[model samples]
Target: MMPLDNRRLLRSIVKLTEKPDVRAFELALLATLTEIVSAKTIRLCKIHESAKPPSQKVVVDVRVSDEEPLGDDASLPTLLIDDAAFLECLAKEEKVVASIGLGPGVRIVHPVKAESKMVGFLVIECEADIPRDQELVSIMLGFYKNYVSLLTHTQRDKLTGLLNGTTFDDKLLKIITAQRVGKMRASDGKGLYYLAMLDIDHFKAVNDKFGHLYGDEVLLLFGRVMVDTFRDSDLLFRVGGEEFVVVLRDVDLAQAVAILDRFRLAIERYPFPQIGKLTTSIGATIISGEDLPASIIDRADKALYYGKNNGRNQLWIYENLIAEGKLKVAKDDSSVELF
Candidate 1:
């Protein structure tokens, strides 16, 4: 964060207010931070940790630079994360403005948190360290933090913190438009995206046997597994009950199948408290730009039900099953409006 001018600040607040969802909100925040800084470049770096973040490298989620933008892999943190900077930032209480001396000038480190847990750092470097920069950073980020909490609360399910069903249609529509699914396999971008429906096998039994507390724990742990297993770009939602959705960004059919099955295996291996072990059945299909949200969900749901009908804990793909004659291409305007 940097010194926020009144007019620039007003515009930043307005821009942030206009974003429809978190992804757009993030990019907008990046743009705002960049605009106010008056620097040659600025980036909104996000740390996506694995099971553990301590040893892992940070992911620069978005950037604005003087040169060509950071390509996906090219955006890996050149920030002095290995030394004290990143760890110190993460450790500090939120709103406690701190700076690590690195890269051309003093870089201000502001910890961004969600639900009291540190999510990432907001790093901005300005050549001239103004007297009130830290106070401004604290004020700017404090507003950001509080609004982020409110927006997150609205967007995510109270139980799982996965995007709620209300967000599904908007999210699905965004991806469908971005990929332009049916008309063309978009260039440079993976032409098609995979949408998968996941259900916990006999989840009702878990609740019945262990009670809702344990069942809720299982769902939470399951949500964590989904987070750890998928890329940040992928969209995840808890549509209803034990059912969930994962939109695999820009991956092909084979990769989608492998990834979904890998998650199934991960669930199977997990020891769920008194429940001991649990598994998930997954069904998925390639998204088509021409398809309605209902139609796309219907395809994935069909595959999911097919897997449930065949076996309790397995993964199935719509096209693969259709090719094998285990499933049929949907006809007769058969579509499920899940959300």
Candidate 2:
């Protein structure tokens, strides 16, 4: 049988794999690490490398003080930028250990790779030199990296790299719960969730004419456009060929319309490798807390189909269509007629 210390250590490492979400994993990582290393502060920093000077969002941070933790930090400035070490770490493809300015605390930043890409950094702050526990930190992070790759493999679409259909239901449930809580938004008098369902206009024709090679390429490029267009907070998913879903987080009707239409326009103007250009039709609706996933999907589908039926490349919001008397939905619940 394994010894008591060995068992406890193994259990801590195994705890890392239990979390299915990348976000929750951040907090879990720090919590588990703190058990072993007596650090002053450790941060799981996610770098938005796409932005100028690169914005940093500390997903999880621990500090030995009675001060506020870094929430949404401001974008790094040109003159006071801290991108050098992160960039250097990413460039050199290795850990960059440094000493805190005029302090005994040692800072260690390691590259976090997931699905064969450098996603972010794991920063450790400790009293003693970090090299002493470098090997242990490396091993723990190796487990983290592998689990992330596996998680993404299960969640992402094979062709597009957008989220696969299997994970949408779980995400939808969480969205409903978050909306129901309505903590920050409740007081602010703003922020609502919108779900958009879209389809590639005449995607069958593209596949029919160009064959699956370019069809696959188009799907791949479509995913790239979504990544470029949507904020990191927004959820993007490919629910099978030509059919996609987007959950626009915390936006008003106007913002939802603007962004959805912008995405449609972007898709319409995107130049395909051999196909020249392509367009998409979108259907969307405001998500209500009481609405079930099936009901929300139904509303979005009605809005989406109306667009395809009318033209082929447009955005339609379900509530707007109903308000305009252009469409009607059944009151299956038999409470009060919503239409």
Candidate 3:
């Protein structure tokens, strides 16, 4: 095969950078790779190193085929970190091409690293190898890694590294809009989105007693706990101060409550340095079809406030509060900005 024109390759790189979100970026990368290598299949697998036991490895975050549309599920195949071939690539910090029994063609797996950390991998399966394919893939992935770093820096909180307050509004809006358009429907006959707000109980007292530095440590540790407790698909945000928000997708009230309660218990059990015990108050509400971003946040915030005022270290559901006449439903007014 002849070499790809340098001008055309530069144009494709520019186009890939145009994608605003990680999902779009993955799809764009797959398309570009398919064209460059004439690949039969391409997939972007996100490595979940934090998952337990055999599952502590890679999951197919997105798969784009010349044969079919992108798949939604991540369960297509789970790549173990302990696998010899995978470990070889990781240890060497380089791309490794190998043959698998699942298909006839050779597969090239390129590690996608950001800030010197392995975030994911790009796998391409093709029958014929183009000249300088590895070099081209490395160049393209470099652009991807840089763009992702920039995007993450802008969207994340400087202190906690969770999604910041500015990004929360847009994320919440997108989730609500997806639900309305039937793009994000729940499978279990439950609500499509669950918005929850969490606050550290007696946070001000912590700063007063333990000094600001120790207080910051508490917040940092809390954020790490949240990351470990929640699924990767769930959007976790540190909107401000000791407060955080989680937007859970496709889960019922029971499931959502259970998840939040589990986190709360974990927080309680964790021993913060110098601090004997710490607890969090949580309030959550289902994202309704007619609800706007601000409205959903307001509901969750109200529930969180209820938990804080009534008893520290407890969880409250907004719908239950409304049914019990403990909280009043706010009229949905699109013009209002609750944040």
Please tell me which predicted candidate would have the highest lDDT against the true structure. Answer: 3
Model 3 CA deviation exceeding 4 Å by range: 1-3, 49-55, 63-87, 128-131, 183-188, 330-339
Cα lDDT of model 2 by residue, 1-339, tens digit: 222266787988778778876666667887877777667866766553233333342222222110111134432112214456666776776998788889777788888777677777777788766454667678778887888787778878888778888878878877776566543352343477789998999999999999988988988888888877876557789998889999887678898999999999999889998899899999998777677888899889888888898888989998899888888655664221233
Q: How accurate is candidate 2 locally (lDDT)?
A: 0.74
lDDT of 1 at 28: 79
Candidate 1: worst-modelled 10 consecutive residues by lDDT:
62-71
Error of 1 at 69 (Å): 14
**lDDT per residue as tens, model 3, 69-93:** 2245654446665456566667777
Q: Highest TM-score: which candidate?
A: 3
Task: Provide the overall lDDT of each model, using Cα atoms, as 2-decimal numbers.
Answer: 0.72, 0.74, 0.77
Structure candidate 2, residue pairs in collision: none
Would you list the rank order by TM-score, best first? Answer: 3, 2, 1
lDDT tens readout by residue for model 1, 157-242: 89988889988877788666654523455454453578899999999999998899999999999999998887655678999999
What are the TM-scores, per candidate, against the unseen true structure?
A: 0.82, 0.84, 0.87
Q: Give each prediction's root-mean-square deviation over alpha carbons.
A: 5.0, 5.2, 4.3
